[model samples]
Target: MLSKKERAEEDALVEEELQAMGPKGLLGMFSTKGAKKKPKLFLELSKAQQRVQGKNSLVLRQLDGDTMSDKLSTYKKTIRFHILAAHDEAITMVKELRGLRQDVNARDEKGRSALHFACRMGSEAAIATLIKEEGSVDEPDLEMRWTPLHYAVMGKHKYAAKLLLKYAPSPYVTVNRRDKIGTTPLMIAAAEGHASIVRFLLDSSADINDRDTYLISQGMTALHYAALTDQVKSVEVLLEYKAKVEIRTKASGETALELAERLGSHLVSVALFECK
Candidate 1:
């Protein structure tokens, strides 16, 4: 009974709604005729919700509390890591995710939450999206104190660390955040070879001199860790940031340069030894 123009307008609106779902659009909702039928994940989603809310109430809520139910759906879907980070496409996804579930939050198996993934992937856009979409920006995962910025530093994603610092710098700067191994982001970056992250943190006014009391004093400063790992560039970067040259690890009783020598890293030793 509708006119052609009205019908066309309605079609366009439906198309827009479909697009609005973003990465989760059309998720297990359709059955292609004659195609091999895949198990419907939404069925599992419904079951999960039913478990949370009794079946009768859930059905009632779906009918009378449609908006709330939609939010719950969005939250559940966001928790799943099925969607790739898709950093390049996060802005639009941000709008959609926020609009769908303003309170969306979730954690992965290793206790690395969405924010952690955002940092590890060096997606500033995704970080912004998570902040604007989810209210739990500063929420630490199972590690209790390790924030997304911490992961960024450990992952050696400088831009991600920078963005995290810019948007949601943890209030507990000097407070040591430990992982399962009681290693701080600074320690992880130092032990491995993430020089850029060390420089970024130090330049951002991070407590370069702070030592982790929880861990054995493996020669605490970013310089000692970098030197131990034979990270030449990292050594130079940390030294430029004024990391102490003479600092020694508690257990090993070795200076950063000594660790570099013992590891057979001549270049790393040269870089650290040459530091004033």
Candidate 2:
């Protein structure tokens, strides 16, 4: 993921590109006339993964894995439109499609916006489009209340996540928003053992002690998830950020120490017991 500095650099580059377009050219970029110039597309397959491509260029790097079943590639692959060159390509696509009544903010059955698609697929160009649209980035999917940033982190695409964090209207809100299951992105990272994301979320000022609603206890925090899951590095990172392991679940009255102990996570149980 880009730091604030890196994202600023990306913004500067986009500004430079936009400036070079002048006025008429910028207008033409979004016109029907530009549609003919849309890039040729292909599904580039690598091992079990697939990313959409425009001729020789990598346009959208969101991959779908194969599991020996019939490989059903998404026909909407054309939506990419070689926009990977700059997210402005998406802006151009939007303008070209505007004559046909497109709701850029429209949600799918799962309540995921196009921005969610962009993040889940690792499409920097598509992400740029959604950011340019500005209304879709923070939209949460219905099932889990997962935002575009959530999809990005779940995809393990830090660059995409960083882009959302840096450019979204409320980066802090997106970073801290909890899903329906009462888990923060931090909890997801800790439980999934995505140590890097845990660190990134912490540095982004995510609440170290934030807890979920109780499915078992009155909700366990990221520390509890990490301890129970035996994510050693994640537990260490949370502790440094002032995570309170002494906090206990309301129902079972079990601290993370007790949970780790019951789960037979020797390393985490020992750390929490000693710290207490």
Candidate 3:
């Protein structure tokens, strides 16, 4: 029979072999005659299990984060689709999504918000809903930097414009906000021949003689746009609102009357001349 020291040395060797084989070898020890020899192998197995559990937990958390991100993206797309549809059911869907805490002010690829599309489409109900939900009114698109008020005026949606003006956090900022080319809502209204919108903008204290920063339209006011576009009624409205007809283009130094005459806008030219 081996001495006590010899048996102890043999136990140490077996333990070293089990550790080198890892948790799998520990399981094999259970089926062997050496199973009962070492009780410390159970501790090694427990440590291996703990490591696997930790890795699994990290993977689960990452999946949850991805799921939340996907839901938010889908919600944004659905809201935009509803705004484009501009019907009662679509508006209802938007409201439902908003009630679920979805972002009402989420922008599309063009950086346009729901309020911007609502105003552009002249959806009065959608506009009211988004406004009541506290969506931004003065948010500008990435491309044109146009606010909701700009779209309303451009579309000649009088009531839509009224709603935006009424609910705007800052009436002056919304009314006088400029686009990428430095054209204000008033300038768009005048150029589009939207006489009513032009008048409303003027009454709302829009800058009547605001000039654009574009090369061709530089230093041109709402009056110049109306005159050049042959917008007779818009010209009349601007004149009634006391738009400065004396304002001249930067490059051409031509006043609204001169541009009107050169463009052959007979009615607008006559209006500008009379105003002068």
Report lDDT (CA) for all predictions.
0.58, 0.64, 0.71
Model 3 clash pairs?
none
The residue-by-residue lDDT of candidate 1 on 1-276, one tens digit each, is 345585456445544544554533533322245657554333234545633553334332433224544433433344332133324347555655657632235543224456666666566776777766643545565634567767677556877766666665463452245554455677677777776666666666666665554455443566766766777877777777777777777777787787778889899887876775
Instruction: For each candidate, give its TM-score against the true structure.
Output: 0.62, 0.64, 0.71
Q: Rank the candidate models, highest TM-score first.
A: 3, 2, 1
lDDT of 3 by residue, 137-250 (tens): 888977679888987886679999999889888898889998888899999999999988898889998988889988654788998888878899999988887888888899
- State which candidate, 2 or 3, has the greater lDDT: 3
In model 2, the runs with Cα more than 4 Å from the true position are 1-101
Each model's backbone clash number: 1, 2, 0
Give candidate 1 misplaced runs (Cα > 4 Å). 1-76, 81-88, 100-102, 143-145, 169-182, 213-219
TM-score of 1: 0.62
Q: Write candidate 2's Cα lDDT for 15-82 as tens digits.
A: 45445646432213323454656532122234233322212222122223242111112112222322
